[model samples]
Target chain A: MLEVKNLTVSFGSHTVVNNVSFSLGEKQWLMIVGPNGAGKSTIVNAISQGVPYRGSVYFSGKDLAGLKPSELARKVGVLSQRRFVSYSFTVEEVVRLGRYAYSSSIFSGRSDDDEAKIEEALEVTGMKPFRGKSVLTLSGGELQRTFLAQVFAQDPRLLILDEPMNHLDLVYQKQMLELIRRWVGENGRAVISVMHDLNHAWAYGTDALLLDKGRVVAWGKTADVLTNENLQSVYSMDVYDWMRSLLSRWSR
Target chain B: MSKRPEGFKPVAYILFAAAMMTVMVLCICAGSVNIPVKDTFTAIWNTVFDLPMPEDIPWSIIILVRLPRVLCVALAGGALSLCGGAMQGLLRNPLADGYTLGVSSGAALGAVIAIAFGIYVPGFALAGTMAMAMLFAFLSLVFILSITYRLDCSLSTNTIILMGVIFTMFANSIMSLIVVFAGERIRSIMFWTMGSFAGSNYVNAIVVFAALLVFGTAILLYSRELNAFAIGEDNARHVGVNVRKVKLVVLISVSALISVCVSISGTVGFVGLVIPHMVRMLAGPNHKRLLPASLFSGAVFLMLADLLGRTMLKPLEIPIGVVTSFIGSVVFVYIFYSSRKAK
Candidate 1:
């Protein structure tokens, strides 16, 4: 389980994520939805230890206040909105990097178990076809999947993805979401993803958190929190009716 | 696409052989005095194979003076360019080179002090000067790295470049003041600053060769770490790279290499800055390929530059620094134009 308590993040004098709190049990998925600059991404970043925050985040009964990046990486896998690669590394090489946290000794060679995990990750993301290809040569959608394969190789207890579907097409979007859902179901892991598409959040997410201007406006089960009133208020658009129709379609 | 070849071993061997041949021929053919290719080969073969010395040619000058100078040039050039290539990876900046981050300026100041003070203590003058250069280079690297650490932020390429520029300006100003105050040693200091292959003997050649071997091997061992760093520090850290530790190791290793080169050759410019970029143009930005390629190409490029410097002016003998800058600027301009066009 993962719990965030009174999380507050500020940039300079302005607050970006204000007094946000939430909890997620194993085998649960929480999708956060908000408009641009609404602090949804900031909250995700704060939870992933990408940014400093004022409050507490606990994972599996341990305080995550001062954990080193490597320690945090072992427990949580994060996929940020922007990923940059400056070298022409093969897809397999990049995925193998995910085993860094688990490698016991620095000088010792990578073991058979590491290769097995990497192969499993490649199989899960369906990136085995391009495993030997240079990541710099990959297309946008294919690159995203490659990164997903890396994240899967991490085998973390908590998965945090910020805009995982940003550049993906509809087919890849479905493929990635289905993979995430299946992984969580089988491993009983916790996932928190920030998404812009309301239909996608409603379709795969078990719970929803709505943020507005860095404040959580509503948080609960997906169906309870994603009301017409809340959606209209948060988005500042008369999209409640459309959202309701979409929700019905998602249920079917 | 067609099935990729099983391995790159054949291409690697071909490149290695080609580079070796080019370096050997260029080394022999270059110098102020025009020794025939046949004579050069005979001299080399006689020395190595312990055969009878040829009577017509002066074997002493070729073996003692010219051979060591050429070897030093090749080794130093290869080491500097390889360091520059590794720096670009370590710093994640395409423009990074051996002299970036103020290492060359620090070395120059060390050399300037050594000459101006006339710090000659019997047989220890050269050793003392080289030690001073290494010390200054290491100190400046530590200062930059400490500042980077204190900031607790990734050292951005822009920040490091700016820091290097500031240090370079400061060192140059101090050097200028020393030059003004002490005019007697001006000739010696100027010679050191302008850079040359003169007076390079077997000792300096051996030192540079050994240093290059050690530094190059150290860098190759960290190839994976360098590749991770290329992706940015946050990602590298997430991938379990000890970013700070790796940065310190690379900084120290490259600083040592640059200091040793500067001690012997006195800041042969442009080879460090341009050769790595040229190598990257041929081989993509993969460090595994780029690092070794840069080393070989840098050696060849500097040998060619030295040859041009030696032969172009004939008896006058233009400085190697001058030739390198002239060639490098043209290449830089071409790169700039082509990159802009591609964009």
Candidate 2:
């Protein structure tokens, strides 16, 4: 479980996220939806403690402020939006970096369990075949999957993802969401993801928070928060009929 | 996935270490006063085991002269190469090194000032030129770091490298001024800038070697953290790497090592820049293997370069910097062409 209270983030005079708050229960998936610059990514970043914020984010009843970076990482795995690797490490090596928090020494930190987890993550991401290939040689979708595998190997209780499906094709997108659903189903984990596609939020999210210009437009169950009027007002488009048709099809 | 495990190859490391030692011995035998390989090995063994040196061996050539020069050369080369690798990892750029970052020029400025005014540390036998060089090197890095820090912008690899180039130009201008003033000693200044180990001794060599051992191990211990950093700073932080701490430790360690190298053996150009690139090409980009491999290969490269410097004209020795630059430029061209072709 994770709780954020009155979180406010700003850069200089420009406020990006203002007075937003939300809590994620165990085994729950919360999707943050908004148009461009709606501060969805900033909200997730504040919760993950990636940037300095004006409010408190508590993880499993512990204040995130008191935790060391490694301590915070033990319970939280974050998949950021942009990842750039200048060097050419093998895919396996990149995945193994997720074990850094579990490592006690530089030389002998990885255990048998860790290796198995790495392999399992690779398998789940469909990257098992390319484990030996240099990450530099991977395509954009493959590279995204490589990072997805890394986060999976981290084995954190709470996963914070910003635009997790950015480079993924339709099959991988469905596969990645299914994997997250299975993880929550099995391990009682929680997920907070920022998504631009309302269809994805409607299908995968148990709860949704709709934001507009750093302000919350609606929050509650995904279906209730993404009402036709709210969708029309937030996006300034007449999508009521389109949203209803899509929801009917998804429900069926 | 392949069934074979993926880690640094032990055989490659062993070969590199053996080659470095072999080249070291060959260098000792091929100096101005050519000592036999057998006598060189015997003297080295005697020194290692505290046995009495044989009377037939030339003590000056084996102990007083060649040994210290060779050790100094190897240590300087190893330290520079390691710093280069660490710099590349820290900034997440393959082209970063002391030479490109102006750290070497900063040390050269310090050395030039000391030589110009005849300023030497009294009663600190190994502390004269080296102490000044290290001081200026530290100051130069601090200046560069502060400028970047004060900008309060995310530190980009391009920005830091550009800062380094600017600092290099500034230092070079001052150095040029000093060179112009020293009408009679221009050749010595030029030789110093070109880099050499001809002026070293056993005392300074031992000191620099000890420093390298201590700091080099510290840097190696951060290979895992460096691996995380290779994925960009945000990912590194997300994965629990203390980005600021890692950067500080790496910067301090690398700057200290570069200062030590420059103090002992002027600014030997491409050993720092090209050795890491060469090692990465051979061993992939894992810092765990690349760091130590670069050290070994850099030692061999510099030893061969210094040897060529000594024997190319059979008495009219070329400068070590000249030899390295020539070889480095060729390697740079080859690497550029190959990388473009691969792409």
Candidate 3:
């Protein structure tokens, strides 16, 4: 269980994320969709403690601000749109880095569970072949999977992703979503993803939060949040009509 | 071709250890006054065993001048490179080093002030100048980092480097003013700032080694955090690294190291930047390996560079800083080209 209570991120007089409050429970996947500058990613940044915000993010009824970095890491994992790595690190090494929260000291050896979790993450993400390959040498989609394996290995209770499907091909996009669905389906885990693709928000997200500028335009079940009126106000366009018209073209 | 994942190997370390020992001995023996190889070993052995003193030039050189200077060079070189590796990783900048970051100039200003005023403390291991140098160095690091955070919260490379350049110029201007008013102390100040091991003694070596032992351990302990840092601070945070705490601890440790080094031998640039790059290439980017390997490689590099400085012009010794800059510039150019092309 995770609760973000009235979280607000502001820079001087300019607010990026304003009074955004939401909760995520087991088996629930929440998608945050908005136009550019709507602060969709800012909410993700706030919840993950990537940026400072004037509010509270409670995880499993515990205040995250009071938690140690290692403790907080065991509860939340994030897969960002881009992973910054300029050095030459193998994919396995990158995945194993997720075990930092579990590891006590660098001098100590890895436990059986640590190794097993890493191996399973590698298998699930299909990054086994690239285990020994440098992260610098990976393709965009392959690199995305490598970091997905990293999050899987982290084994957190909640996963927060920012544009997880950015730069992914159609095939990889489907595979990554399927893997994430299974991940949440098994462990009583919850997820929050920032998505630009409205179709993906409809298909994959259980609940939705639509944002415009810095405020919430609509929130609740995906169907309710994506209604014609809600979409029109936020996007200022006939989104459902356009989608339905496009749907007719694909019909057999 | 894919590189096979390589982990810790005892053999590489064993060879590295041997090379360290061999290079140190060679450096000690091959100075302007060439001591015999046998005498060099014999002198060290007798001193270690506390046997009878040999009344010889070779023995005195090993006991008095060369040994202490070599020891100090090793400590300074190793610490400089270690800090460079950590800073580069933290900022995700290839060009980050003590000299480039303006920390050396700040420490140099501290040391210059101490030298100009003839500040010295009897009975204390670290002189008054070294203490001042460390303080100013840490302050400089804080100054630049806070400035970068203010300009850009991400601590991007360009902002950090710009702040560092401006700070270095400011510090150097103050140093030049000190030089102007220094009077008779100008020669010592210039020679020291240019960087040399000619003035090193046992006290300087031992004190610096103590500082390195304390702070170097701190940096080495944060190797995991540095590894995460390379992947971006947000990624590191999600992995449970306390970024603020790590930043505080590592910055303090690195500053302390650079201060002690600059206080001993003025602004030996590029050892930190170059050695870490080499270590990462050889042992991979895992900080666990890179940190220790940096210590060893940097020590050897400095010993050799100092040896070249002493013997290059025979009667006229080149400053150790000049020698490093000469070599560092070439290597740095290669790295600059390669890193840009990588993008």
Which candidate leads the pack in TM-score? 3
Candidate 3 whole-model C-alpha lDDT, 0 to 1: 0.87
TM-score against native, each model: 0.81, 0.90, 0.95
Candidate 3 structure quality by residue, lDDT tens digits, B1-343: 2233334588878988899999988988988789988889889899989998677746877878899999999989999999999988887777788877889888988878877887768867357888888888989988888888989987766687788889988997888888889877644555545687887998888888898889999998888899888777778888899899999999989988998998878888789988998988888888878888999999999999999999999978999989988888788888878987888
Mind giving the per-residue lDDT tens digits that candidate 2 earns over A69-176? Answer: 888888899987686667889899999888778887666745887888899999988899998899988877788889889988988889888998886789878888
**Predictions in order: lDDT:** 0.79, 0.82, 0.87
Model 3: how far residue A20 lies from native, Å: 2.6
Per residue, candidate 1 scores C-alpha lDDT tens digits across A1-252 of: 898999999999999899999999999999999888889989878887777899999998888667776687888888765766655677877777787777665577667777788889999899999998988778778888888888888888898889999878899889989999998996559899999998888899999999999999999999998888888898777777766676687686
Scored against the true structure, residue A51 in model 2 reaches a CA lDDT of 80
The CAPRI class of candidate 3 is: medium
DockQ scores for all predicted structures: 0.38, 0.66, 0.64
lDDT of 3 by residue, A179-211 (tens): 999998965699999999999999999999999
What is the CA-based DockQ of model 3? 0.64
Query: Pairing residues by index, what is the TM-score of model 1?
Result: 0.81
Give one digit per residue, the lDDT tens place, for model 2 in B5-27. Answer: 44467897778778888888999
- Residue-wise C-alpha lDDT for candidate 1, range B1-343, written one tens digit per residue: 2233222357795886598566757666566666787888899899999999979877876888778888888888889888888888887766577565678778877767777787545775567666677778888777765676566456655577677768867877787788788787654554555578888888998888888888778886677778777766666776667777888788878887888888888777667669878777777666767788788788888888887777877788888888887876686567546544543
Name the candidate that leads on DockQ: 2
